[model samples]
Target: MSAAQDPGTPPRPHAMLIAQITDPHIGLQPGPATGPLDPTGSLRRALAHVRALQPAVDVLLLTGDLADSGRPQDYAEIATLLADTLPTPADGGPRVLAVPGNHDRRAPARQALAAAMPVAPDAPGDCVCLHVEHGGLHLIGLDTVVPGAAHGALAAEQLAWLQRHLTACAGAPVLIFMHHPPLISGMAAMDACGLLQGRAELGRIVAAHGGVQAIAAGHLHRAIVGQLGGAPVVVAPSSSHQLTLDLRPDAPLALRFEPPMIGLYRWTAADGIACHFSYVEAFGPSHPI
Candidate 1:
């Protein structure tokens, strides 16, 4: 694909709401593992905020950091909670989407969400991709989980799959989802977990393809959106608890009950994409109708 468009032609952007929910640190207890975090409880509250949105959302994307530990049971817990709580077409709401993060154990996560897992059981690999078309828009979810590492990387296999999908889409506008950020944000300490090992190769793949509208990710426990090698990247905040960024090793365990955040990304065939964020408060500001 060429960088500059020919005269009389302009880059086209797809319009759709891709709701990104990240880092709902499940199974977090109030003790050492969680460091005074209430992951399960917090996620419940956050869901309430999401349920009350005025305009409603189209697609639901969970950005990862799924379980506190990479245990099979933790994954089961996530599957159960998500099925009951999150919005979906069956429940008169948006269809749910997800990708695995560092905290997510690929094996168990794959077993439970068999639909999303790449190769089926007895297959050599595990990964899943979804194609959703809503109002002249398409969204795709990609898996980027690597076993036994604080850092994140997208494998050659996954990239190959992404390439094929983008090629198939042709001119259709698309949004890519993953567990790790393809790029980094500020805050030195948290940046360690932000690296994608084969990023250069991934860039070339995206460079070769022109349909990707934006890339959204989860990790870092903070809200950030920026450009990566010419692509838009948005990082969603965790619903469970946030990792306070303090480069100092000696700083006290800095965890707090900052209300978890949820997003409302609005897209219109005429207007392109826009986003808004709000927290899980006890009771939202009152209004007169």
Candidate 2:
């Protein structure tokens, strides 16, 4: 069976399996196995996991935080790793898609993923919002990063662009991906720095759009589910260390060396979209249930 296949989800020959790898946070150098976690190493392990998936995934969605410091060299390193690790088909297919995180620099990220992000004459050269259509589904990448701020917010122009695109989809199944989730996750310190002010406007657009299937995001470093504007919103965990899972109102800011995780989104006309979470790092030998 493919690593992405969930035994519970009976195989559907026509289903699209998309691998979601978020928040790798690769640094200037390779990550170490122990001590403070290394983002690059974690990313390598995640990629390996994706490569091992049965029958191969239709596409890989990288949900942001590609670099730890948004540095030029860091992006260069990421570009190199992606070139080396991403699956390439003899038929020359679309293998990966990404958006920028609050930790990513616009110019550097744009340069790094130039091919995936072609220049639109009407759009800014540095615009990170991207639209892609595959197998009758629409995937939109929304830029939620606030300049020079840890928090995220969608500007008026972004919300407008989103509505225009969603409107054009004409009721096709749409899945939106962004760095910061539009809703609060109850992690006090993190929620305090969550997607700021613009969520309502974005929510309004989503609620009005009937085609949107789900909004997926990354940033909290933990898998979570919530709703924004009546649409299902999913927050994918990091491929590296996770944030401490504290739901208390007074929870302190902290990180934990938890086993990394990734999300697999299985899409079919019959099922719509079904998401399954799987750990990237192996723990022990598998035994038959």
Candidate 3:
């Protein structure tokens, strides 16, 4: 794809709002009242907040780890909760886009989710292509789910498909959402379980494509920002449980009692992309950010 822009047709300024929630781990039973692992309540409240947004979010892109165990019941709960939270097409309900995490089983995801959710456009119907034009900004969902493994990988077919779609845009503003980060975070443990195998190849594809205005991810269960191929890359905070950020492996398995929060991303062609690591009014802030 030519990296040139058309000065005359000047890229139209756009403002788009996306509500991103990641690593809900929604199926796990809340830990004892004394503990902070209230996946169910946190998720419930988080969804409520998303619903109550004044302008209404144009889309809800879940970055994965939807289930605690990839269980059928867990996905069922997610489907039902989402059914209540998501808007009706008549009322201009926010478009819902989701990809599986290490904890999610694609088969169960298929069974539990309603057929209405959009699939990936270029792939077969099994893989969803969720494309939404929110305030003129395009948000594209990519699947990096690899079952029975903690790691994630984008198959060659998917990578080629992504290149094609991104190139076709011809410099149009775009955002890509996926389950795993293509680059490593500082945490060594996470790096071991993050995107696997095709790092260099993926970077080449992304760097070569100029339309990726920004890229969003989930899986790390933290709100992280870094660069991948010169585009802004964001990782959403987990809703159900927290990943202990302690870079030291000697650190205890830390899951704090903080109330759930979701990451909100605002993207525009005019001012570029801005992010808010926002929490619902009822939640507390205990992390050392």
Candidate 4:
């Protein structure tokens, strides 16, 4: 049973609201296009949505693919927008945390966005693996980017470090964030290029720990819910454009101009965790039911 189910102990008074934004693909200023959609404008609208949330979120998780070409100027654009417009969390914690997508080059990403992320001494060359503790919750980030490849993989060293961290947090719920979705999405095109290796070992670690709340990821460019290592795997929608949903085994890869969106993960001692997807552009005003 969970902490909330323990009859002899008081329910833990901890809860967290996290906003996840992914695959911004913030290309250069001229025109950033993923199909017919303009990535830059889409991201601007997405951040606008985050600011409009009621009571604000506790932390913002940028799940990679930050830049289309991994260009310095593209990262600069993101930095400028985050520095100027991203809302400060209600609890006064760190503003945002991020990882690198396949599209992001390590040197540039580290030089540009590393300061905004947590740090771990054991992280391998330019790999962004780290952890953060907030409101009695543990958040772990793993770098799954494989140099010169579209698919992702976690090195054994990084996995070992992650195991150490998970072991240390045995009694507390730990949320793991990475760029690639570990499970196979029914969308064949995306799954073909998903996490390329080390998934089973990672799964075993999570299964053994038993304290992991959920695994949140991006790169599929759509919302997908599945199981990996007996834990919930959530694939968030891109903040820029979405992958055309075609479940056929031979479905051609395509992009759609669907309204970009963000993912929200809410966790409490009693409920454990729940996730929802919301559009970046408002369709209408909310009505009290």
Q: lDDT winner among the candidates?
A: 4
* Tens digit of per-residue lDDT, candidate 4, span 1-289: 1111112223336556888999999983433553465777778777778877865677688899999889998888888777666744433432588898999987777777765565677667778886877656677888999978889998788888888888777758888999998998889888888898889999999999988888999999988998778889999999977899999999999888777779888888678898889888878888999
Instruction: Supply candidate 4's per-residue lDDT for 171.
Output: 59
TM-score of 2: 0.89
228 in model 1: Cα distance from truth in Å?
1.6
Please identify which of the two predictions, 1 or 4, would achieve the higher TM-score against the true structure: 4
Clashing pairs in 4: none
Best by TM-score: 4
Taking the tens digit of each residue's C-alpha lDDT, what string does model 2 give over 1-289? 0011112233346788888899988783433534567788888888888877775787788888888888887777777877777656433323577888888888887888775544233443356877777666677888777778889888877777778788877776888989999888889898888898689988889888876778889999998999888888898899987899999999888888888899888887678888888898777778999
Candidates 1 and 3: which is better by lDDT? Answer: 3
For model 1, name the residue pairs that clash: 116-128, 117-127, 118-127
Clashes of each: 3, 2, 6, 0
What's the TM-score of every candidate structure? 0.81, 0.89, 0.84, 0.90
Q: Which is superior by lDDT, 2 or 3? A: 2
Q: What ranges in model 3 sit over 4 Å off? A: 1-14, 30-34, 124-134, 249-253, 283-289
Q: Residue by residue across 1-289, what tens digits does model 3's lDDT show?
A: 2222212322335456788888888767764642656677777778888888766676788888888898899888888888887775457666667877788887788688744345654563355445544455666677777767898887787777667767776667788888888877877778778888666676787788766777888888777888778787888778876677877755544565554567787766777778777776654646896
lDDT of each: 0.65, 0.78, 0.72, 0.80
Give the lDDT of residue 20 in candidate 1. Answer: 66
Q: Give lDDT: candidate 1, residue 11.
A: 36
Worst 10 residues of 2 by lDDT: 1-10
lDDT of 4: 0.80
